[model samples]
Target chain A: ELQKQFKQQEEHAGSLQASMNTTQEEITQLRHKHTMVKAAIQEAKWKQANLTRRVLKLVSAQEIERKRGVPLDQTEEQ
Target chain B: LMRQAAHVNAWDQLLQQGHDQVQQLRLTLNNVKTDQSRLQAELDFIQGQQQELEQLIEPLEAAAASTTPAQHQG
Candidate 1:
């Protein structure tokens, strides 16, 4: 009976150890994924800023073109 | 039995530590998501402001165009 209990405890401890190892691996993977996602979000923000600048530049160019008395289609042709 | 008790105690401690690490990771993930959302909102706001500014400039641009040719021809 004592031997049986020892066997059971050993099996239980082994299972717990395996569970701990898997959980640790998963946590590490999740952390890596999180880092990647954070970087992507930052890159997207930079792209957004770049897009805003382009829009402003286009608007400024439009204003200049309007002042030049160029029709819209003619401006595009040029 | 004594050795088994010691093993069980150590295993339990390991489990507790693992749980704490998972909790910390979850918190960090939540923080990253929140930051992404806030930046997205700010981007939307900036786009809206840019549209408004562009709209305001349109009529002014037209008026300037109309006035300039008259000044040249006068």
Candidate 2:
């Protein structure tokens, strides 16, 4: 009976060790993926800002042309 | 006629990649928040699970002009 109990304890300990190993692996991968997502978010932010500034510059140039073409004085006289 | 009507340039094409930024946000949000049918894996460091996620996600959701969809699931 004592031998049987020792055998059962060994099996339980083995399974617990395996569980811990797998959980550790999971946590490491979790951190890796978390870092990746954060990096992607940061890149998206800068890219968006860069693209937006370019767009705004284009709009500003168009506004200058419009103001030049449509003089405020001419409209006021009319 | 198409050439005059269409102002296609390398700069314009480069700026068009901004579409990928939108897709990246969507993918990141989905990665953090699972939808439907089990299989939800959350960061263990944060306490109160979904509550912590709400705090983390609020700014992004606010920027997108969309309110939080999942109030509970923990």
Candidate of highest lDDT? 1
Query: What is the DockQ of the complex in model 2?
Result: 0.01
* TM-score, chain A, candidate 2: 0.75
lDDT of 1 by residue, A12-72 (tens): 8678668766866776787688677767767766766776677678677767866675676
Computed on alpha carbons, the lDDT of every model, listed in order, comes to 0.73, 0.49
| RMSD of candidate 1 to true structure, Å | 8.4
Off by over 4 Å in 1: A70-78, B1-74
In model 2, state the lDDT of residue A67. 77
Interface root mean square deviation for model 2, in Å? Answer: 26.8
DockQ each candidate and list the results.
Answer: 0.14, 0.01
Query: What TM value does the first chain of each candidate achieve?
Result: 0.72, 0.75
Off by over 4 Å in 2: A72-78, B1-74
Shares of reference contacts reproduced by the candidates, in order, are: 0.08, 0.00
